[model samples]
Target: MTGNARLDLAIFDAVDIDTVGAFYAGLTGWDIVRKDGERFGLRTPEGQEIEFQRAPDHVPPRWPGQEFPQQFHLDLETDDPQAQVERAIRLGATRLADGPAWITMADPAGHPFDLCQADGVGPVMRLFAVTVDAPDASELARFYADLTGMRLVHDHPEGALITDGERNLMFQRVDDYNPPRWPDPAYPQQAHLDLVVDDLVTAQARALELGARRLSAGGERYRVFTDPADHPFCLVW
Candidate 1:
């Protein structure tokens, strides 16, 4: 393992950038740390960075459906799951489901997330895991484990979770999953990940060797590649 890569940012595409940015900032109590004409961003207190890009005519995904399946979802940990759910509703989240351990909610932009119960009170929300939908969870998990040098932390029949020291990523099997086509408006990549590397050439070579296909060269500083499951991720130096 190179051990030289780290997750730099998670980018979301939203139809209304300001509204989505405000929703997340209010929900996480994070300030807008970066902003430009087309993008907005926030850095959580725990150092996780997220950015939103404006996508004109974007159609929010309909989770658990064939129309536009949710390619990914974030899991947030809360000491008081119910209370957190209530607060999120006040911040424009719609509760989709509630249970003893986890509560599902959709954000203002219709991205699904889970408020999972935790042992103690901490930040209003903590970035727990970014879960991706795949036809073969085991295969995707192994591919990322090799690419990021993260260890497999949790294994289930239909899913698996992996973690580097700083970030956690999960993969879950989705029935009849419809993968997004890059730069396709009808089936857009709702969100994507950015990984920072010290040497882009070395990282790109290793990624191709480990089963990633080059989709586009974003620029001298960034390049886009798709994982085995067709999810796009950028390797940046």
Candidate 2:
């Protein structure tokens, strides 16, 4: 892909687009940029976009388990995690787990995300990272780092982190990791990514060489592919 693919959008599947979009909008204070019968889109203050697609048969992931795995999740940072956790609960989130400096919660659509305590001054709530579950964190991190040209800031056996200065993509080792079977609602891809590229053909070829499998489903303007870990991502122009 010439290592120039830009991670454009992070997308999640939801049965009720409006409810899921409203929940995240209330939690993050992001503006709802687009909403239609088929999809909903929200934009972060930094201009990063998160989209929800209509999936009537969408199946929610089962976090902390491999049977119906949570393939990906967002990590949100805030100065006061406790208050944010409360606010999120009031906004229709259910507390999943708690830690000293972080709290895990499931959104209305059953997507698991974290409210982590941040050290520096910033927005009340900001997206800190988008973490993906993988059998080998280092391997997945390396694949993305090579594809997107994101700098690998941290590399370990258990986990890995990569950033493009503005956005962070993390990978964590999951025990008995179960990859999604896309195009199959029973084993739905709870979330996926959209990578923007200047040339679709070139990017698709390079991505295939980097262990991405091109999927049969795609539109003329975009093509779908799965990463090394079977996480569905798109190459869009």
Candidate 3:
């Protein structure tokens, strides 16, 4: 199937944009492309952008638990996990867990991410995937696959993966996932995805037909909608 939208940006809500933005920039070696009083944007070597928006009253997620669940986390591939972990720690990341193949750490804003050991000799580090939590990984994966027209690369009961070769989107099974209530600061959306489309009207209609719920929040150039799993995403023209 053809993709209705192209993944453009991944945005995170942080209490302090400077701290969070600087931490990610130091870790990923990405340059700050856009910076303002309340918002900061960093662009990867490949031009993929990760933005952080200031949310003074942002409520951080509690990972490894259902209470204030983490809506999403980034997986970064690194050649030397130990070195990267050390660097991350120095950059204000707190070590959360350790595994043979991956090391989990929480960023300055309390978002958990993994420093996964890469297989071959490549760049020192690169973004591996953007993973979201769901009650049913298989079902959510299918929904995103159909919505983004990405190929399902891995499917299992616990997790699922969809990719367009370079970039990947993953779904992990959470026992009791607590979705975000957007437009409500009490239960904030920690992070969200922005998808670009050629035609906003057609794309919004298609998204709604594919089990997406229209949200009341949006602007002229874009419209907001929540996926089947209730994570906020935008269709931008």
Best-fitting candidate, scored by TM-score: 2
Question: Per lDDT, what order, best first?
Answer: 2, 3, 1
Q: Please list the C-alpha lDDT of all candidates, in the order they appear.
A: 0.84, 0.88, 0.85
Evaluated against the true structure, the overall lDDT of model 3 is 0.85
Q: Between candidates 1 and 2, name the one with more favorable lDDT.
A: 2
How many residue-pair clashes does candidate 2 contain?
A: 0
> What shift in Å separates residue 62 of candidate 3 from its native position after superposition?
2.2
Point out where model 2 deviates above 4 Å. 121-123
Off by over 4 Å in 3: 1-3, 120-124
Each model's TM-score? 0.93, 0.95, 0.94
- Expressed as tens digits, the lDDT of each residue in 43-91 for candidate 2 is 8777778899998998887677888888999998888888888888999
Tell me the alpha-carbon RMSD of every candidate: 1.7, 1.4, 1.6
**Could you arrange the candidates by TM-score from highest to lowest?**
2, 3, 1
Better of 1 and 3 by lDDT: 3
Best by lDDT: 2
